[model samples]
Target chain A: MREVVVPLAQRSYTIAIGEGLLDRRDLLAPIVAGRQVAIVSNVTVAPLYAARLRAALEPDADCVIEVALPDGEAHKHWGTLNAIFDALLEHRFDRSAILVALGGGVVGDMTGFAAAVYQRGIDFIQVPTTLLAQVDSSVGGKTGINHPLGKNMIGAFHQPRLVLADVGCLATLPERELSAGLAEVIKHGAIADAAYLDAVERALPALLARDPGALADTVARSCEIKAGVVGSDERESGLRAILNFGHTFGHAIEAGLGYGEWLHGEAVGAGMVMAADLSRRLGLLDAAAAGRLRDAIAAAGLPVRGPAWPADRYVELMSVDKKAERGTPRFVLLEGLGRACVRRAPDDAVRETLAACAPG
Target chain B: MREVVVPLAQRSYTIAIGEGLLDRRDLLAPIVAGRQVAIVSNVTVAPLYAARLRAALEPDADCVIEVALPDGEAHKHWGTLNAIFDALLEHRFDRSAILVALGGGVVGDMTGFAAAVYQRGIDFIQVPTTLLAQVDSSVGGKTGINHPLGKNMIGAFHQPRLVLADVGCLATLPERELSAGLAEVIKHGAIADAAYLDAVERALPALLARDPGALADTVARSCEIKAGVVGSDERESGLRAILNFGHTFGHAIEAGLGYGEWLHGEAVGAGMVMAADLSRRLGLLDAAAAGRLRDAIAAAGLPVRGPAWPADRYVELMSVDKKAERGTPRFVLLEGLGRACVRRAPDDAVRETLAACAPG
Candidate 1:
């Protein structure tokens, strides 16, 4: 077992990574013991894990409540988020109640948000069951639902009490979803660590093949990298924007193709390639480095190209992204293999990159 | 002009109380300069003051957008909040956008909440038109919409950059509404300063007659008392709960009668009386003190008696209040002329107070 602490002062909590941690009553008890506990998950992940998680929580929890939302990114809106509130209110859960998020990114995001706004604010624990969530979504305190105008357009910076990343749950993740998770894992290396990127490239087969050792190592490293960035810039005022290295373009891809058509990480996977290409075109990154990043993304079985859409349409979608400031979309481009910076590229350069990356 | 600074560290803001502060460009410029400004007002208040507020903001703001929502607490739900988001997104307002809440408590709350969640969080200025908002809601960082189950069941504690409390706007306030505002003003005195409560009782006629001096004095004192409480306990962990002196029962009154049937302050007015009666029954307060508080409420033209509801129903509603812990309703009872404490009362005593205070 490996534990990484996200140092967020009073809001800090540990991310525990290992196999079969879900059944570890010893680990779950301290957080849920004698407290009203609500386990929020989606239909897909809840059926597989909710009961076991409930079994572990029922022993010490004052009472256990289960709220299973509809599955998929398309449901990540106000209407779906309200279901959690409806259940909590129906059960008459008070401020002292604790919510445990027990699914992937979609579940984690919605559950975290529900906890953030429920009775002004309350405590919540993250038990991420997907690779994408374990490394990225579960670490940062960013919790919200998507607006029709843009993805993650509404949210709060509410940190969790604890994050339990049980690797055993990853066995249930579909093949394509696992690759999508790797997009963020790959992002962790691409934005901050060159040696880690090489390690990921070499361990690609082992990670894809569900090797426990490889999966655990990458999740820990990715968490540490993200926690460090989030700790320094908790509100994303400055250094935190680097974490969105590919998100500006990735959000455009998701919105353009209509959400849920491609997984978020899948969109991010292709978005990173386009960002690197843009970096190279501006002479900030070499062709060799850009190509290397694309090869690793492709080898991980994630898309390296977006849906064929006009450059103007992609630009239009990107302009509405949360990362955009005053209608101008700011791109997060890599100056090198291990360094990322946020800035606005020339209109022509952005258009050319979009046209070249996703040829219609 | 009187300014009280809410000392909340980085989230600290000033509540500027005076007549005609709404048209003060010097005060509004620093916050709105070079930023997209969204003036969120209700249909009732917009036709009255939104144009004047917008005119003052146009010189410094990049652009000023007006969003007139349906008025009243009945509309303080997800649908109304979505309208604010819709307008902001429609105009492509970015993270740097500043939301100006130009109405009473309902507008202030929804606008503050809209600013809190829009693009995660953004800057907002409170331009409270109603005396109720100026004295209470505008000073607190609490922002959220009501859920079907409970009032303020969903929200975030996102403080504003500035709070502009224009006493001039109170001139257009209805007689009942002005009296409703006095309920909170009386609460501040009842919970924190006995002398302030005495002053309010003496000045009731002047306050009712719309005397600018008396109104300004009460507003400033109310802001100071509320600010002191909020600064110490921003998340309502301990001391802040005292500030909800009558809110537990008040919220029940609003929910029980159906929201918008009785104004929030009117319910709070009657709730305060019931709470005082409960305190007296609990042996924490004397009959004379309770009567004095009730008389002040009555003198201010606010309700001193609640609607005749079954004791069990009120008990059940209070049990779901945010202040309740572990399904037990914690009462904020007054111990003396100007003292408050939170604890669970004997069920019999609570029932007795309800019967004595509100007779069908």
Candidate 2:
């Protein structure tokens, strides 16, 4: 097992990444504060792992309740988030009770958000089942639901008490979902670590093949980078914005295409490519480095080309992104292969990048 | 104007309490950051003060948008909150844009919550018009919408950038609404200060008669106590829970009676009497002190006796209160006249208090 501690002083928590760590009572005991536990999973994950997690927690918890929501990114909204609240209230789960989020990103986000607003705030644990969640969403405290107008427009920065990412859970992830997770893995490397990016490129084949060591290593490294970034700037006041390297464009893509149509990682994968192209256009990143980053993303079975939306349409959508301050859209572009910086791109340069990277 | 600084480190803010402070451009200028500002007021407050606030902010802000929501506690829900988000998105309000809550507690709570969850978080100021809001809700950062199941159940603890309590606005307030605000004023005194409580008791007639000096002093003193409590325990982990002295029973009364039937302060007024009775039963408060507390509540033109809900029903309702932990309802009971302590009352004792305080 590998542990990466997010040093947030009093709100600090640990992300435990390993194979078969789900049922570890020792790992779950310290964080599970109250006797009552509500394991919030989705329909897809509930049928598979909810029972196992419940059994694991049964001995420790006085009342182990399960609320399995309908699965999908489309289900990530007020209605679904309220269902978690309703269940918590129905079961008489109090502030001291722990809410265990036991699914993928959608589940984790909604559960974390539910915990954030449930009775002002409650302790919650993230048990991410997919690689996308394990490496990205579960580590950071950015939990929220999407609005009709914008993705993640409504949410809170509520950190979890503990995050348990079982590498073995990845065995069940769909191939596309696994690839989607790699999009964030590649993002972590593309933003901060060149050696990690090189390692990811070398381990692509093994990672796709579900090699336990490669998956564990990748998850641990991604979480470490994320934990480090999140630790320094918990509220995204400055340095933390780098983590959204591809997210502005990715969010626009997700919102434009409709939330559930393209998985978050898929949009991020394509968005990263567009961002690199924009970086190259701005003379911040050399063409060869941008090309290499695209190659790595593609090698991980992720998309390099964005959808053929008009440049103006993309601009319009991106302008509404959360990263956009005042009226200017802030893009997290690569300074080189391994470093990211937030910059406002010229309209023509953004247009050129859109024109170059859009699908023919 | 009197300023009470809530010393919450970087998130610290001030409550500026005075008469006619709303139209003072000097007070609103420093806190209202960003060019774009949205004044979230209700239908009632729109005609009254929104224009004055907009006129004051116009000199500093480039764009001042007004969103007038339907007024009342019933309107404090997701639909209304989403409307704020929709307007923000439609108008393209960014993270840097400011949302000024220009109404009563409902407006302040919803607007603060909207700011909290809007684009992860944004800055908001509270221009509390009602005494309930000016003295209480606007000072602390307890912003949220109510759920169908509970009051203030779905929300975030997002503090305002500034709180402007214009004592002059109280001139237009309904007599009942003015009295409702007094409940919170009484609560601050009952929980923290004996002298403040005595002053409130003595100033009841003048306060009810809308004596500006008396009202300002009362609001300033109440805010001072609240600012101190909130600064020490921002997240309600320990000392802050004392601020909810009457709130546990108050919330149940509000929820049980169907929100809006009785104003929040009215419920809290009766709830405080019940809490005092329970404290006396626990031997923490003397019967004479409890009676004096009830007498003061009545003197403030607030309800001292609660509606006759069966004891079991009160127990059931209070059990689901956010303050309840691990299936036990935590009551913030008065220790004699001034100090407050959080304690779990025996079920029968709580039942007795309910029976004693319930209307015959």
Candidate 3:
């Protein structure tokens, strides 16, 4: 397993990436701190892995409880977050209580946020079962619920105490979900590591074939890159904006297409392509690289394009994205693979990018 | 003006307490570091001091936007917070945009929360126009909105860079509100300083008469006591819970009677009395000291007894308070004047206190 610490003092936690590492007492013991445990999972992941994760947390812990939320991005709202709070309060969870999120990005985000608002804040562990969470959301401390007006419009930059990405759990993940997770892996490459991008491109076949070693390496490398960026810019002050490379265009797609209709990472995959295409159009990137990027995403069997929702709708949706300033949308544009900067391109360029993204 | 610092590195700010701190550039200068300002106030405070505060800020700043939210605790909700966000976003507010919250606790809590959540976070100043805010809420980093399920159920610990509490502003406050602010003033005395409590009792007449020096001293002492408590226990791990001396019982009153029925400080005033009485009953407090504490609040003309609310209702409301654990209520019981501790007293003790609060 590889470990990457996010460098936040006191609130910092290490991300553990390896196959079948969830049951490792060495990693779990230090973070849990002899507190009562509450495992928050979802219906989909509960039956598969919750019991095992709970059993593994034990022999040493007591007063443990489990509350499973309904699975899916659709449930990442105030209601779902309240259920976790209800469970915490009902179970008498206190400042010392530890919440273990045992699912994908949705569970991780919601559980972290619940910990944040529950008595100002509490400690939570991220046991990301999905690849998307393993590399991206699980590493960053951003936790919040989606506002009807925007995605991730409300949240806290709450770092986790520890993260355990048990790749063994991924065996039960749906094919569509696995494809979605790749979008984030691709994001790390696009923003900070050209070599990693090349590796992902070259090893797409083995990674797709669910080769455990390749999958684990990709997750760890993605985490290492993210941890470095987050360490320097914990709250997306500057360098972290690069991590949102395709997110500006991607979030617009998720919102314009109507949320839940598109998996976040899937929208992110298509969004990365849109950003690359825009960079190519702006002469900031090579057309060949853009094609390679798009082809690799397509080769992974992820959607590359969708019917154009109105450009205006995309604009409206992007306004509420976390990267948005006041109301003006901030785009994380590429200088090239492995380099990104935030700036406002010409309106025509943004409109054109939206126009190009329309279904063919 | 007396100044108190929260002492948190990078996120720390000062609380300036005096009769005319707002008119002084020294306090405002350190906080308004930029050329643009956003003064978030309410109609009640805007007509009174917005122009003056804006003038003080404008000499060194430009493009000031004054967004007026409806005045009152009833408006401290998600919709109102969103207005602040919308205005900030609508104006292309950068991270440097200074948000000045220029009203009482409601405005401070909402705007501070908005600053905390807006674009991950931003700079804000607390130009608190009410005494409750000046003495308590304005200095603490606690920022959030009341959820449908609980008060402060959604929030972050985003501290303001500066707090300018012009005691002169309190001159225009209505009598009921003035009395309400005294609850926090009394709270400072109850939890930390015995001499301060004696001084408050001695100076009650002058304070009621709005003597500038007397009022300013009260405000300064309160902030100093709060800063000391907060600096030691920023996230309420221990010492900070003492600051909630009246709040545990107060939240129950506010939630039980419905949010708008009693202003927060008013409920806190009554709640303090009940807690003191409970502590007396528990033999953890001296009966004479408890009586004196209750008398101090009552002499301030604030409620010393809770209104008739069902036991089940109080229980339901208290469970959602920030101090609650699992469905169990946690009350901050006074050991004596100037000292408080968090303890789970018996249900019978709480019932007796409530019975004492029943209208004859």
Quick one: best lDDT, which candidate?
1
Tens-place lDDT digits, model 2, residues A1-360: 888898899999888989888888888876663478999999999988888888788887878999999999888899999898899877767667789999999999999999888877888999999999999998779999988777788888989989999999999999999999999999999999999999999999999999988999999999999989999999889999999998888887887887778888999999999999999888899989988988988988888888888888888888777678755898999999789999888899988888898843
- Name every residue pair that clashes in candidate 2: none
Pairing residues by index, what is the TM-score of model 2? 0.95
Find the candidate with the highest TM-score and give its number.
Answer: 1
- Which residue runs does candidate 1 get wrong by more than 4 Å? none
| Model 3 complex DockQ against the native | 0.34
Give the per-residue Cα lDDT of candidate 2 at B249.
85
Question: What TM-scores do the predictions have?
Answer: 0.97, 0.95, 0.84
lDDT of 1 by residue, B289-324 (tens): 999899989888888888898888899888777677
TM-score per model for chain B alone?
A: 0.98, 0.97, 0.95
Model 2 per-residue lDDT at B127: 90
DockQ scores of all models, one per candidate: 0.80, 0.69, 0.34
Q: Give the per-residue lDDT of model 3 (tens digit) for B84-151.
A: 87787666666667788888888888888888766556778888887788888877788877655556
Ranking by DockQ: 1, 2, 3
lDDT of all predictions, in order shown? 0.90, 0.88, 0.81
